[model samples]
Target: MNILVTGGNGQLGSELKHIAFQYPQLNCMFTDVEELDITNQDDIISYVEEHNVGLIINCAAYTAVDKAESDIERARIINATAVKNLIKACELSSAKLIHISTDYVFNGEAFCPLKESDQVIPLGVYGLTKLEGEQYVVSSNEEGIIIRTSWLYSSFGNNFVKTMMRLGVERESLGVIFDQVGTPTYAADLAGAIMSIINSNEKLDKKGKVYHYSNEGVASWYDFALAIFELSGIKCIVNPIEASEYPTPAKRPYYSVLNKKKIKNDFNISIPYWRDSLRSCLYEIEKSN
Candidate 1:
């Protein structure tokens, strides 16, 4: 089967590229906007038809939360309208779509881990557009999976872990917000789960599915930074700070921890602990350097 992965150079897409070789049966083509613009429905149709893509893993998104506030049109075009174009193309090609979403779709007021069935109340433009994308994904009759993940980082791209590692060395001290709570997801793990779902014997197109995925533990941004420093042996004092202390244009969910029981049970996917995955990513990063 032909598998088309959009956002080819993104964190998740990069990880997917790293692991694609293991699944030799599926012919996977990774593409970024320069390669294939999902905003143009005709382009998506042409690419899918030419590639004979039976599945699409859409990782393309406008993830700049703070910047999205100022660039609403750009964000909306990428995160919402572009998704509609993909859905239309997927329908024409009879391709199942595996769309990636974020935990920001909910307001940070929840007392517990978020479930797939939980209410969605986006706090800012980025989250709102992502939610709009999810709406388009699920509202379709085509078979697909919508994965909402949080705190994603990987060795292949710039992320919280890499940022902490960089700043930890350049500066002696760093203040990370401790108020926000969530789990960190290694892109490799999420990519593995995606591969498993598509490679499984059962037909995923038989039913529509949405699942929450992250590392198997909880952490605040402070804790995450601390782990990065510890794993990398970076001698930096990571001070705890409140979200209000370092305010941004967009408000983040104070509590966006996701519940992974559904995905684990459904796909039999094994999720490593946050620290374990962090260490693994750090090891790869350090080795590469």
Candidate 2:
């Protein structure tokens, strides 16, 4: 299969690039805005045709949560309009799409893990626009799978793990939100799951559907940060703080934990625990440095 991955430099995209080498049978092409601007339908279609792309993993997104509140136009254009353009291009090429979505689709009020069928009530402009992007793919009658994930981190990008790692070294103490709860997803693991889905024998009957995935366990921002410090052997003391202590322009969901039963059963894959993956991720980071 000829696979096209957008947002090639981002966390998940970088992991996909790192793992793509393992799949010698799949011809993978990585591209960012410079190589493939998703907002332009004509350019996307042209590239799809030229490359004969069979599967498109769209990782490009407007992920600045607080910043989106002030730049709704740019966020909407990228998250919604750009997605519509990609859907059209995929339709013309008869290609399948694997869209990366967010757990922020929910209002974050659920006490338990959120499922794919839950009610969507986005809390901020970023979440709202991301939800809009998912709808475009769902309603376009295209062959695709929308995987909604949460709290992604990787060695390659600016994410929570990197942020905490930096803070642990620079400061003697740090305050992280303990009230907001969710899983900390390792981008490498998520990348593996995507590849597994691509190579699975599961029918297209499950196509054009939404699914949820992350690491196996749940944690608050405080717990996640503490794990980072402990695993990295940093001496910083991470204090648990309520969400109100560090408020941003966009409101964060109180609970965004995603249920993986649907994705696990559908793809027949096992997920790793959050702490286990955190250790592995930290090890990789250390090796790189």
Candidate 3:
């Protein structure tokens, strides 16, 4: 099967490229924005047609949470409008589109884990726009799978894990928000899960559906930092603070743990816990250095 991947330079996209070789039957085409602009319907249509793409894994997104407040239009263009174009392209090619979404869709009010069917009440522009993208996929008649993940990190690109690791080496003490709680999804794990679904072809019908996935277990930003320090053997003091103590342009959800039961049952894949994935990622980072 021929698979097309967007945002090929991003964390998830880069990791997908690394593992694509493992699946010999899968023909993968990885493209960044420079090669194929997702915002342009014509570009997407041409690429899909030329490649005879059977599946589209959309990893492109406007991920600046704080900056999104000042630049809502740019965010909408990338997050919502671009996705709409992708959906249209998928419709034309009769390809299955797996779009990556985020946990920020929720307002962070719920104390328990978020299920796929839960009501959405995004608190910021970034979250709202991402949710809009998800809605567009669901409304389209094309075959699609919307996966909502949280606190994603990888060996590539900018993410919380890398940020903490950098700060641990430079600073004597780092302050992290202890109030916010969620699972830290390793991009490799998510990529693996997507590949599993594509290979199985059981859970998703031609019609579109939504699902939630993340690494097992939960942690605050503070706890996550502590784990990084412990795993990397970085001698830095991690100071735990409340969300209000560290203000940002966007309001983050205090709790956004996604329930993986549906995806687990449907795909029949095992997920590593957050700490275990962290260890694996840190180990990879160490080897690279």
> What 10-residue stretch in candidate 3 is worst by lDDT?
201-210
CA deviation > 4 Å runs, candidate 1: 205-208
Q: Write the residue-wise lDDT of candidate 3 on 1-289 in tens digits.
A: 8999999999999999989999999999999999988999999999999999989999999999999999999999999999999988888899889999999999999989999999999999999999999999898888778999999999988899889888889999999999999999999999999989988877464323889999999999999999999999999998889999999999999999999898888778899999999999998888887
lDDT digits (tens) for residues 192-262 of candidate 2: 99999989957543633999999999899999999998888999998899999998999989999999999
Work out the TM-score per prediction. Answer: 0.98, 0.98, 0.98
Over 125-173, each residue of candidate 1 has an lDDT whose tens digit, in order, gives 9999999999998888887889999999999878988888889989989
Would you list the C-alpha lDDT of every candidate in the order shown?
0.91, 0.91, 0.92
Every model: Cα RMSD to truth: 1.0, 1.0, 1.1
TM-score quality measure for candidate 2: 0.98
Q: Which segments of model 2 are wrong by more than 4 Å?
A: 204-208
